[model samples]
Target: MSAADTTTPTKVPLPRQAPPPTAPITPPGRRTSGGATVPWALLAPCLLILALVLGYPLVRLVTLSFQEFGQSQLWGFKPAESVGFDNFAEVLGDGEFWAVVVRTVVFAAACVLFTMVVGMLVALLLQRVSGWVKTLINIALVASWGMPIIVATTVFKWLFDSDYGIFNALLSKLPGVDMIGHNWFASGPEGLAVITLLVVWGAVPFVVITLSAGLTQVPKELEEAARLDGAGAWGVFRYVTLPILKPIVVMLTTLSVIWDMGVFPQVFVMRNGHPEAEFQLLTTYSYDKAFVVNDYAQGSAIALLTVVLLLGVIGVYMRQMLKIGEVE
Candidate 1:
């Protein structure tokens, strides 16, 4: 056809192909139901294990706390009788229980304070030391952390023994000191002080390792910047390093409190399984009530109360963690 006449067959545009399917858009701050369930699904096995391991004992403890379950019922000679709030009332009313509670609190606070302070100091030292020295320190920490509680307690007990303890011998060698036959456990406060040292000794390793790891995550550049701004060692740590390490500190403190408060083997074994009234912590107090005095229900009630108190601490920890998460 002639060029002009070739007005040609007009080309027709093919319709645009539809875009390929895509995932549905979820709104901000929300997830798809299936996506949301993934975390729970991943956690189900752990939750199930915890429920199986802890559920029955917790339920039994609560039930026993509300009943009159003494040696008679314990051996099946008589049925456990429901006593409503009697067990709780008796425990709450006893002056000794309050004393034990106060002692436990003070002991835990002391342990936590010493643990954090020593741990932080060691962690800072680790940062400044040579590689080999840091490795050596870490190895020592791990070794101590791995030591069994019973073994450690025995070692500490011998160290502070009334007659032949090396600790006493060393003290006696000092000028004008006569500690050759000193009995560390003769008084309640003195004995508790020794146990506190042991607890702090054992607990320091974990805190050190954890804090050291946390310190590694701290941005060195931020610390350097702080230094450039005329910050001293303490200032850099307080303003820069500490805020970064707050969560770890909180977690370690909470765990230390829980562990120190629940200490039993130390006091029990130190006193040959019969911690005197002066040496009694909540754990030993409950043990004395349940086994020594054969007051099972009252012991359960005391233990339950201790659990509630610990739960409060855990609640505070969770709240702090959530706040930190939000801030981040």
Candidate 2:
């Protein structure tokens, strides 16, 4: 080739540029779905089950609260006759219902406060203990919780029984005691006290476990630093430990309130709605209205009211939880 031809670049056909590789088509079965869509599809069954089991009943309950039973329809369906707000008016106006509600709120509040304080104290003690003692304490508390509620109720009832109660027997041994066999569940306030004691006994272990877990999350360094700064044990706990534990404490308190408010078996077995329903909390009241008196309408109304109260309590709790860091 001439120098000029050699210097010139060879006219080799440029390699054809290949089209950008396309994504492999997912087979109808093998294709992965969108992030949001797949979750919703998988959740469909659970949502359906929740609606059927929880949603429908709650809706039915609210509906029943607004209706009264009437003659069965020709199709054999007994549609409730709407009574507008009569049920609400009746429930609100009933002195007994309001009394029970007030008692429930007070009892639940007492239970939550006492249980949280006692449980935190117990947890602090447990943290100070060592090895086998810690294990033993845990086992004992867990065992108490594992006992069946009915069994616990029966045992407590016997402990507080009018004739054969150990509590009265112990009282008899005290100096100058006149009444040895006081009936714990004879009056409204007294019965509520007994119920509150039983509920606190059953619930404290859970608080202990939860609070102890929260305590573990508190940094040892922070505690040591607080101590070096001349902060006393109480001061450290008040400022450092408690602030960290606020969320867990709030959660436990909320749960305890919810649990104690709905308590039934302890009061039921202790008194059986005795002394003219003196010991009837909302749960027992609803049960008695539904089954004993066959007043399903009243029962449904009670249930719906109880639900509203609980929801309100939960809303307050959530608000408190949200406001935890605001003060600090």
| Weakest lDDT window of 10 consecutive positions for candidate 2 | 69-78
Query: What tens-digit string does per-residue lDDT give for candidate 2 at 1-328?
Result: 7788768576989899999999988778664756668889999999999999999899988887788843242234866678988988988899999988887788888998899999999999988999899999999999999999889988888888888899889888889884567987667777677778888889989999998999999999999999999999999999999989989988888888889889888877776544356677899888887767766777889999999989998999989977876776
Whole-model lDDT for model 2 versus the true structure?
0.84
TM-score of 1: 0.89
- Show how many residue pairs clash in every candidate, following the order shown: 0, 0
Report the Cα lDDT for residue 237, model 2. 95
Point out the worst 10-residue segment of candidate 1 by lDDT. Answer: 1-10
Model 2 TM-score, all chains together: 0.83
Model 2 alpha-carbon miss at residue 182, Å: 2.4
